[model samples]
Target: MMQMPELLHSQKNSLFTAMNRFIGAVNNMDQTVMVPSLLRDVPLQKRDPDHGSYLRDAEADMYTYYTHLKSIRNEIEWGVLREDQRRKERAANTAVNAANLEAEGEDGNDLEQLLQYHLKGLHGVLAKLTSQANNLTNRYKQEIGIAGWGQ
Candidate 1:
């Protein structure tokens, strides 16, 4: 007989595998697989000796899993945005400092140009990240059956 710990581990592995498959389907834009995978089995209220309870546990577990995944995904996305913005801001500041140094005859035009170029690249990257974040946010909202997130 399998121990409780082993059973739990197996169940967790199964859930993780399913989650990865579901995410892959979503990424691939396979709606047929994605929809059914998202709609996991419903959990049973109690274990019955005669009747099976696979669907019961599956339903409850899937709901809980989805909720937790959503939170984690949101945190990761916001963290990326925050880091990107911080990097861009730092680059902009560095460029400004370089310009000031050039004005004070402390640095050459080449250094200043390099800083300016970096600042421009940072800005461009930040814009693209922001757009990607917006798309992800919209997709999550739609998937979870929430109305628009007010942009």
Candidate 2:
């Protein structure tokens, strides 16, 4: 008899936004602090040892975010599947108590719309991350004087 609560949806949105922001912040860390050998074209072999550690640490952070994003995507997909199963199960019960099970004119298809909305948000974050990654890579190349070197 109770409809889905709006707070749950809002909380989900907030959590996703927070996650996106966290990833962005981590990605945008103080590269200057990370690479103290600033403006120097020190090759990988001659670079400071901390450079290796910095790369490793950055990789770990990105891996963690990747896992979390994958988990979220799977969670949303499974959640949508669960709702479909629930709707199918309820179809049988609606025969006996149609009034209680069904609203006046609502067909309860909002879940699909919600799924789409979440998917769009997910893809949007993915695009942002991808663009940021490309920018980071390009910046690294530029720092090492390879991206536009001798051009």
lDDT per residue (tens digit) for residues 1-151 in model 2: 6657897677555646655554553344323124534513332221236555423232334324333444544554355357778888788777755765365544558657767888778667765654544444445556656675322
Q: For candidate 1, lDDT tens digit of each residue in 19-115?
A: 4443443343322224534534433233455876422343454434444444544553455457778899899999998788778776567778987
Candidate 2: how large is its RMSD?
14.7
Prediction RMSDs, each to the true structure: 18.6, 14.7
Which TM-score value belongs to model 2?
A: 0.32
User: Cα lDDT of all candidates, in order?
Assistant: 0.50, 0.50
TM-score of each predicted structure versus truth: 0.31, 0.32
Measured by TM-score, the strongest candidate is 2
Q: How many pairs of residues collide in each model?
A: 8, 0
